[model samples]
Target: MAKISLRPLDDRVVVQPQEAEEMTAGGIVLPDAAREKPLRGTIVAVGPGKMLDSGNRGELTVAVGDTVIYGRYGGSDIEVDGKEMKILRESDILAKVL
Candidate 1:
């Protein structure tokens, strides 16, 4: 696949979600119907911080290449180069994966 060149705008982020585990540690293979949406992903792109009413932009806590966890229903699903991705607001991010 080609490198994604998308740039988010205004506190938004482009995330590439991790694929769901197909098997458990106990060797149980899960079917597609049993899989859930992944809440974790790596940040592929970041937008500038949110614009403040005072004309200053708020700082963004997350940076590019950071792995993040978000709300289950938070982001908008999108596809780029036939690969699934999510676009979410910075506020939607729950935690950074160190």
Candidate 2:
């Protein structure tokens, strides 16, 4: 894989969408229309931590290259360098994907 990466501006982070989880029930393969949309993604790039007014660092809990599960209603969808991605503040991240 190419190691190309972009730094997110300000307090934003970049995430690449992950494939949907497998469905195993009655030995049936689900159709695309029947599958739930994936709400988790792989971290690709991240910005420097959000800065503080006091000239101190506001640490971001997540870093680049982590798998994360995010809220479906959060984030602004985007395409960075022709790859689909989400741009959101670190606070918008819900949890790390196990």
TM-score of each: 0.93, 0.77
Residue ranges of candidate 2 with Cα displaced over 4 Å: 1-5, 21-24
Tens-digit lDDT track of model 2 for 50-78: 77899976777787788888888778887
lDDT of 1 by residue, 1-98 (tens): 24587989899999999999899889999999998889999998889889999999998999888999999999899999889999999999999997
Q: In model 1, state the lDDT of residue 1.
A: 29
The weakest ten consecutive residues by lDDT in model 1 span 1-10
Position 2, candidate 1: lDDT:
42
Question: Model 1 off-target regions past 4 Å?
Answer: none
Backbone clash total, candidate 2: 0
